[model samples]
Target: MAEGGITVTIDDAEVRAGLARVLAQLGNMAPVMEDIGRTLGNLTEDAFQASGPGWAALRPVTVARRGSAAPILQVSGGLAGSITHGGDATKAWVGASKVYAAAQQFGMPQGYAGRTRRGAPIPWGDIPPRPYLPIQDGGLLPAAQSEVLAILTRALESAVG
Candidate 1:
């Protein structure tokens, strides 16, 4: 008892009950996160397909975090995946590493040296720009947004009601 005749004491039972409730709520979030991840993956894949062959080979991968169970959507494939979304040479990689993807997506210098199939040196002639990813506004994003919103709305309703 303190000055106001109020006493604060540790209640192990109450603490246990509160922890249980929190754990239960956390348990419910996994399925919702997984559903969201799948939906996003499908949407991204569709966008890639519509873009063109240059972007169609990429695939969407979803990974769930171990601590928070949050979902992360990523576009992945081999070397092609690096430059599909946008033209950049920063992430290009070969045996060691090189900046060639951007040259292909954008264009190489007039007389840049490149290799032939037989490893012979050849002039890197003019290469045309070919962008194939992140489909334009009238592409897959709008539909994906709607579907994702619907899924999240349902999840919220189920969780609350």
Candidate 2:
């Protein structure tokens, strides 16, 4: 792709275009989707409380942004711990707290940091960086912003520590 060395596959470009379209769609769904996230959490809480191990075994567990990534907590007794994904950071995600510590401490092998408001890096490393939101106002967000923003926000909010 970098000027004439490796031949770029058609599928590669198709995937990129498809992702852009998805991002635009996500921009439209941002607010409502955020609410849906809350509802799912609430439903899980109620169901788990009502019945023992209601969703624990199958838990829709996704450890990283990519679905292919192996779950940090697949079907363990939960000392293994679940992972999160985020989008537009409603709570502090791309903030000054290293999420990796928790993953390491809890015995998670690997995880994703997720994205910021417009797909910027959230905090990382043993020392977390200060949260810097490139687009403070939602109106300033670009069309491509949603995919990263949406998932990362959810992940960090779910992680919280």
lDDT of each: 0.36, 0.31
Task: Report how far residue 12 has shifted in candidate 2, in Å.
Answer: 28
Best by TM-score: 1
Per-residue C-alpha lDDT of model 2 across residues 23-134, encoded as one tens digit per residue? 4444444543454344433332332334322112211333233354333223342321232213242221121123332332222212333322244443332222211122
TM-scores of all models? Answer: 0.33, 0.21
Model 2 TM-score relative to the real fold = 0.21
What C-alpha lDDT, on a 0 to 100 scale, does residue 140 get in candidate 1?
Answer: 27
Model 2: residues with Cα > 4 Å off, grouped in runs: 1-27, 52-161
lDDT of 1 by residue, 27-140 (tens): 454555456445644544553355433432221221222232121112333323432211111111111011443433334454555532344333333544333222233332
Q: Where does model 1 exceed 4 Å of error? A: 1-27, 52-140
